[model samples]
Target: MALWKHLVQAASAITLAAAFTSVASAQETVNIGYTGPLSGGAALYGKNTLVGLEMAAKEINEAGGFEVGGKKYKFNIVALDDKYSPSEAAVNAKRLKSQNNTPMVFTPHSGGAFAIQAFNEQDNFILGAYTSVPNMTERGNKLTLRIPPSFAGYVQPFINVEMKAFGKKLAMAGGDHDYAKAWAQLFGPAWKQAGGEIVAENPMSYNKDTDFYSGVSRVLAANPDVLFVGGASEPTALVAKQARELGFKGGFVVMDQAKLDEMAAVVGGMDMLEGSVGVLPLIYDKRPGTEAFIAKFKKLYDRNPGTEASYHYSTLNAVSEAMKLAGTVSDPKAIHAKLSEAYGKLPPERNPARITSVDDRGGTNANIVVGMVKNGKVETIEAASLGQ
Candidate 1:
């Protein structure tokens, strides 16, 4: 009787082990690629973008992963640092496609996105572009997906507000990077068209130069009513602080690359950011799903999620949904076609940016919330009315 009881216990243990193995065998991994500035002046921005993708992947895995083509799949993000260089980004894309066979590669900067666009179709991977540059989708790349709405929508509203509050004269003191340069180019002509004068144009290297006093002072010498300055949040804050130190008490038209909330953190508070206009930071978003997403993000990372983090998180979730709808995890064309449908299918909680549709050119349409620093507080001056 003792021998029989021992044999029965051994049999039960074997059955449990087999069940665990079976469950493990049923799950498969799907690789996704992220190439951006993991180190350098733009490191924080890149890290924020990566965390968003990682957070979404984590949530999807915790929910037992999504199913596609009759197989259960979990996500594995293969990340590489490009140091914010377009050439390095191109190299990383080749490696990701050759080694991991990733169906998609996300890049935060416009330069890197354009670099990838040159060859993403040939390599059969989708370019998950995070840039708001209108040309990102306009060039007709089949597998390209522009996560954020075009920055073109901000020009008119910015002109309306700044030209009214400040004066007709504007000075350009933004970063010299490709993204900032594009912004300055757009703003300069638009500001002129709106009956404003470009008193000065001084582009600074916001990434490399810590001392923006020279550039800021140069722009201030023009005695402009509004200073157009922005880059990454840190350096942009420095530029604004120095302008204030120099007694330039006028309004500011901040480029969208530099977040107002992050700039405020660096320069002390919202009081320092009075009369600034830019994208509405996710923390100030009163949309229905934004609060819950922020709460979840804070619980996970122990800090507030910015527009970069929230947008990427929601975009990644939409991509995963697109995969399921396309019925395959590896086909870029199918997933691209289904993206619009998939975006509408997401539960509101999973979509903090509130993406509504994907157009034929692969650009997303959403409520581009714009905010302004008015009387020491960030207020939503425009929402849903623009970027539709």
Candidate 2:
């Protein structure tokens, strides 16, 4: 009886080991690379977006690793902290490509996106960029999958609204980075077209311009109707806070980088955000499945997902669906084609709340919906997209 008992225990161990090996064998893993500011001043934006991407991966794995054309794949996200530096983004991209053979990479920063885009096609990996710079897809890079609407999309709703409702004369102040320059270019012309004038343009270095009070105070001196404050989430909030403390009562532009929740936390609620206009995140956009996504995201990350997370989630969803259709995750051309195809299939009813279209250039066209902050919450106002 003792020998029989020992044999049974041995058999059980063997069976468990076989099961584990089989589970591993059944699912094939594909590592997706992400390089962004996982630490430093922009950690909130980068980490939250990483959470959204991982959340998508989790859901896909839970649903039994999608099978396409008899090929099964389990996706894993590989992220590295770039400290929000473009050179670091390139270095990490090389590491991810060499070490992990990542089929695709997501970089939320425009400067980093540019770095990735420069060689991604030659490297034969798809570039999943969250930057809203209008010219990203215009470069005609097939591997470039720009997931968010261009800054041009924010013009009609954010700038135009602030122009008419708040005041006609507007002032712009932000980091003199390429992304901010693109935004200023787009918004400046849009406001000009709307019969408004840009009173002052204040450009400062992102890291050096920590004391926004000094610069913003000068911009406020212009006494414009609205101030388009640009930068990462924390800096934008700081600028807004400084503007408020300086007794400047007017509208603000959140520059697509700042999350309302984080901004509220920093500036003490939505009282300072009244008449502010900017990207409406999932928590406020209420796009189809937005609330569901928000609930799931909150449950996983224990915080409200802002635009960074929501758009990353949407793009990650698009990428997954594209891979499933393309039947191969490593083929750049196939994945690129399927991305646009998947976008066509995903609608509001199909859980496509923010995205409206994906053009051939791989540029996404999401409808313009600006959020107005009221008492620490957001109120959304839909507006037409660029050229609409």
Candidate 3:
């Protein structure tokens, strides 16, 4: 009888150990790879984007993980800094796919998005682009998606106002990347049609550019009524600051890639960014959806979420919900299709209002409200005022 008791106790211990192991294995982790500029001039853009991505992951994991394949999988990100370089992004994408086995990878710019797109189809992964370039979805890559309204839409309204209020002479300066090149090229025809003359076009490598004094001086000498401050918030702010110091104060036509509020802090005065207009800030949008996101984001990060990161947040939430609907986290193709189907059907609990708009190419056709810096903040302008 004593020997029988010993055997039964050993069997009970084995059962308990097996139960613990089963529970631990049930909560599997799903990692998504993200590539962007985390330590360069565009670090703020990349970091803010990552902040939203991570916040989404944390919220999903906190809600007992995303259900897939009859098991619960926690979402996480294996992010790498690509410095907004296509070459680095390609290499990073390859590594993330082969080594990390991530179903999706996030890139914040057109260059990186294109690099990943060149081969992501073959590698079988989704390219989540937090980009402002229209070409991102123009090619019809089934796996690629644009995050926000393209830089393509920002020019018509901007030039409409600048040509009338500022003057007819305009000069453009930006990096030679795909998005910057697209911005400069797309704005020219609009400017010309609106009775504005393109006085000069100066393109530099943001990766190599340390000082804009030389470019700003030369461009200012051309007697431009508006200097197009291009690229992300940091470089755009830098251009605004340098231009102000160089005494070019007619007007600053900021690009949509950067956040105006962030740039306002850098340039440090309404006098500097006065008459400057770009994308509308979420704080200014005041939509119930946007306001709620702002409140939730502020509660966690103690600050307002910017445009780029907010797109990232929407993408993450949408992707996870799609995965749950797809019922297979490993299949990118299924998840991508399900993403299109589940776009607006996301549960209200999972930031339902974020499904604001989705174009045919899976890109978000978010609003393109250009506002000038009034009273040290971005004040929205009526599109009708610009004849847009």
**What is residue 8's positional error in candidate 1, in angstroms?**
18
**Segments in model 2 whose C-alpha atoms lie over 4 Å from true places:** 1-27, 347-353, 374-377, 385-388
lDDT per residue, candidate 2, 1-388, as tens digits? Answer: 9999999999999999999988767457888999999889778778867877888788878888777778677889999999999999999998999899888989988889988878888888988888778888889888888888777767777766676568788888877877777787787888888888889889766645667877887888889889988776667888888888899888887787666666777777888888787777567656557777877877876877766777777777777788888888778789888887776666453343467668888888766677877655688777764233
Candidate 3 lDDT for residue 19: 96
Query: What tens-digit string does per-residue lDDT give for candidate 3 at 1-388?
Result: 9999999999999999999988776447777999989997778778988987898898888989877777888887999999979899999999999988999998887778888888998999999887767778888788876777667767888887776678999988777766677788788777887788889888766656768888888888898999886776777888888888888767777777667777777767556788787777767766566677788888998987786666777778888878888888889988887775565765444442354556768676544557877656678775546666
lDDT (Cα atoms) of all candidates against the true structure: 0.89, 0.79, 0.78
Candidate 2 at 365: error in angstroms? 1.6
Tell me how far the alpha carbon of residue 331 in candidate 1 is from the true structure, in angstroms, after superposition: 1.1
Top-lDDT candidate index: 1
What is the clash count of model 1?
0
* Model 1 residue 212 distance off true place after TM-score fit, in angstroms: 3.4
Candidate 2: give the clashing pairs. none
Candidate order by lDDT, decreasing, is 1, 2, 3
Q: Model 1, range 290-376, lDDT digits (tens) per residue?
A: 999999999998999988888888888998899999998888999899999988888878999888889999999886778889999
What is the overall TM-score of model 2 with all chains considered together? 0.86
